[model samples]
Target chain A: AQTVTQSQPEMSVQEAETVTLSCTYDTSESDYYLFWYKQPPSRQMILVIRQEAYKQQNATENRFSVNFQKAAKSFSLKISDSQLGDAAMYFCAYRSPLRDDKIIFGKGTRLHILP
Target chain B: GAGVSQSPSNKVTEKGKDVELRCDPISGHTALYWYRQRLGQGLEFLIYFQGNSAPDKSGLPSDRFSAERTGESVSTLTIQRTQQEDSAVYLCASSSSQGSANSPLHFGNGTRLTVT
Candidate 1:
């Protein structure tokens, strides 16, 4: 079984600043996928960024990037130039490369953007 | 629809009653998933269906919860003798292909179920 952990329950960042949300997972599989999902008050899950375990280079999507340390079993999400729209509940997820492709999610961290 | 669609955006039912939640995945998507989200918590995988493959119900919390997907289209999650703890938001998602690490999931707004 794979378990994702987000130590921070809540986080706040000032507008236009940068913020990093930590995530760690325990998985025995050598090949897998890591993802960060954002859910606003609307309760819609949106993909933020994703990282492949086999890739040494981190994944970057515009202002959202990920720091993936496979050896340490750590995958963190970084949001640069944070805006009010970035305020949401962020979740770290783990998915197997196998056929099942079921995602296991962390408890989540509520992000707040301050003006 | 252009995206994943879940029916009955909100449902209220009495405890011990059976409820069914529907999900309409994006057209041409081969993978569909069901997840449960409790208040202020992350999503928990409930079931998954990949094309014609047998569905994975390993994540289901109890035998009372069951789900079925017809081919690559609509899916329904049924909870029998629902309990108060079953109250939560049920989310449905679909992906373009199976076992594609780069494919991101498209999610629906989710059905908020309240069992009183």
Candidate 2:
């Protein structure tokens, strides 16, 4: 069984600053994927970024990037130059490379942007 | 639909009643997924459909919950004899292909279900 863990329950960052949300997971499979999703008040889950387990290089999407440490099974998201729109619930997810693509999610960290 | 569309953005049902939530995935998408999000909680995987493969119901919390997908298009999740604990937001998502390390799910605005 694969399980994702988000240690931070809530986080806040000043506008134009940076913040990092920590995430860790436990999985037996060597091939898999890690993801960060943001859910606004509208209730739509938006893909923030993704990292492939095999890729040693971390994933980056504009202001959103991930520190993917495969050996330690830690995948943390870094948000640089935060904006008010960044206020949302951020979730870290895990997906297996095998047949069943069910995503295992961690309890999200609510991010608040202090203007 | 242009994106994943879930019907009945909000549903209120009584305990012991049955409810059905619908999800219309994007055209040509081969994968569909159902997830539950309780208040102040993470998204819980409920079921998954990939092409013609047998659906994965491993995440379903109980047998009272069942889901069906017609071909590779629309899907419906049914909860029979719903309980208060079943109250949560039902989210639907779709991907261009089967679950892989590369495919990312596109989610729809979930349906908020309230069982009283």
Candidate 3:
């Protein structure tokens, strides 16, 4: 079984500043994929960024990026120049394509961007 | 639909009744998922189907909860004898990896099920 953990229940950052949301997972598989998802009040889950366990280069999507530590089993998401739009519930996820291809999501962190 | 579509945006049913929620995944998407999101809680996975095949179903909350997909197209989740605990938003998603192993799931707006 695999599980994802997001220890921070809530976090706040000032506008134009950067924020990082921490996440960790437990899986025996060596190769897998990790992701960050954002859900606003509209109730739509949007993909934020993704990181491949085999890729040490880390994944960056504009202001969104991930710091994936395979050995440490940690995958954290960083949002640069945070804006009001970045205020939402962020979730960390783990996916094992080789095993069952099922994606597991963490408890989630509520991010608040202050103006 | 261009994106993952779910029917009955909001459903208010009485307790002990049955409710059926529908989800239409994106075209050509073979992986479908059902999840329950309670207020202030993370997404709790209910079921997953790959091309109409569900390998593991132990994630379902109870025997009253059931889900099925039709050939990678539409999926329906049925909850019998609904309880107050079942009053939450039911979300559906579909994924396609294409040639790579890393794929992002496209999510629907979700159906908010309320059991009164």
User: Which residue pairs does candidate 1 place in steric collision?
Assistant: none
Error of 3 at A3 (Å): 1.6
Give the number of the best model, judged by DockQ.
2
Docking model 1 quality class: medium
Cα RMSD of predicted structure 3: 1.2
Every model's DockQ, to 2 decimals? 0.72, 0.79, 0.68
lDDT of 3 by residue, B1-116 (tens): 69999989999999999999999999998888899999999999889888898889998999999999876789999999999999999999998747435878899999999999
Predicted structure with the largest TM-score when compared to the true one? 3
* Model 1 lDDT at residue B27: 94
Candidate 3: give the clashing pairs.
none
Best-matching candidate per lDDT: 3
C-alpha lDDT values of all predictions = 0.91, 0.91, 0.92
What TM-score goes with each of the models? 0.94, 0.95, 0.96
List clashing residue pairs in candidate 2: none
Tell me the tens digit of each residue's lDDT in model 2 across B13-107. 99999999999998988888899999989988888888745456778899999888888788999999999999999999988874455788999
- Model 1 clash tally? 0
